[model samples]
Target: MSMIEFKLNGKPVAFDGNPLKRLLDVIRDDFGITGTKEGCGEGECGACSVLKDGKLVTSCIIPVGAVGGCEIITIEGLRDTPQGKCLVESFAEGGAVQCGFCIPGMVMAAEALLMNNPHPTEADIRLAISGNICRCTGYDLIVESILLASKKGEGLW
Candidate 1:
């Protein structure tokens, strides 16, 4: 077992558990952050994505020890941010959200993309969300949402 300390949302927290325990399990079971979904145990799916020090990563594949002293931002934390609100609105307005299982990870990935490339092309948007798969929208609406969001200034987010 190992002791891991990190910022969850904006608050500091610590846990003692197996070093290899998935961050998803620690968040969902120990920390009670259910917004970060577990679609796949492996890292291929983005359903378990979260921001680790402001970069998108599959929480399921991240061992608890790996997150020691890191700041972890889950979907629950995103909902409280201005960027998150903008993305959520754009997602709903553009019909990008469906079934809702993949929306959080999609939104997180989109936010990361927008942060890096404020004016991304359609192909860039596609590539940004490539790690995330949606069984519901076929990606057209999702792409549209990212494009629409890019026009907004980073300060707005």
Candidate 2:
């Protein structure tokens, strides 16, 4: 076992476990942050998405040892920010959520895209969330919700 330290949702966190344990497991089992779901347990599904140092990553494929000294942001972390709130409200207003299995990762992907490109086009929105898959909402509402959130400008940052 190794002691890995990192920042989670703006707070410092430490985990003592196998260095190679999947980050998804560490976040969910060790840290008790259940918002980062495990879908495929592989990189194919975006259900395990998280932000490591402001970059979107699939926690399921990432090793806990690789995240030391990094800033990891899970869905719970996003809920604590204005941008997160905007995304959630936009998703609800646009009716982009259903079943909710994919919403958390979708939200994080949207947040990363908006933070980098405040004025993204429809194509940009689609491309940003391409890694995330939703079985509900037909993606139209999800696209619309991202567009709506993008329209909110800096307030989301």
Candidate 3:
């Protein structure tokens, strides 16, 4: 086991695990941050999305060793941010969630997108969240909520 040091949710954290262990497992199992889901173990799906140094990343495929010295942001980290709450509220109001499995990752992806481009067009929103698949919602409402949030200026970083 190797000791890894990083910042999670804006706080310092350390964990002992295999160097190649997935960051998603470390966050969910070791740190009790279950918001980062394990959908496809590969990087194809954004189910394990997290922000590494303010950029959207798939935690499931990232090794713990690669995360050291970086700041990490999970869905839970957004509770204290206006952007996070706004998007969540909009998602609910827009009926963007169903089954709820993909909500966390989708939200994180949306946050990253909105932070970079608060006024993203529909195509931008679609491309940004394309990695995340929601088997339940068919993505119509999801896109709608993001577009709505963008127009409202909720995604400003």
Per-model RMSD to reference? 1.2, 0.9, 1.2
**Model 2 alpha-carbon miss at residue 90, Å:** 0.2
Local distance difference test, per candidate? 0.88, 0.91, 0.89
Which digits, one per residue and each the tens of the lDDT, describe model 3 over residues 5-50?
A: 9999999999887989889999998899898899999988888999
List TM-scores for all candidates, in order. Answer: 0.95, 0.97, 0.95
Q: Which stretches of candidate 3 lie over 4 Å from their true place?
A: none
User: Model 1, range 1-157, lDDT digits (tens) per residue?
Assistant: 7788989998999989898899999999999899889998898889999999989999989898898889999888987788888888888889887799999999999988887778889999999899998999879999998887776545664
Residue-level lDDT of model 2, residues 44-117, one tens digit each, is: 77999999999999999999999999999999999878889889999999999889999999999999998899
Stretches of candidate 2 exceeding 4 Å from the true structure = 153-155
Clashes (candidate 3) = 0
Candidate 1 TM-score over all chains jointly = 0.95
- Counted clashes in each candidate structure: 0, 0, 0
What C-alpha lDDT does candidate 3 achieve relative to the native structure? 0.89
Measured with C-alpha atoms, the lDDT of residue 21 in candidate 2 is: 97
**Highest-scoring model, lDDT:** 2
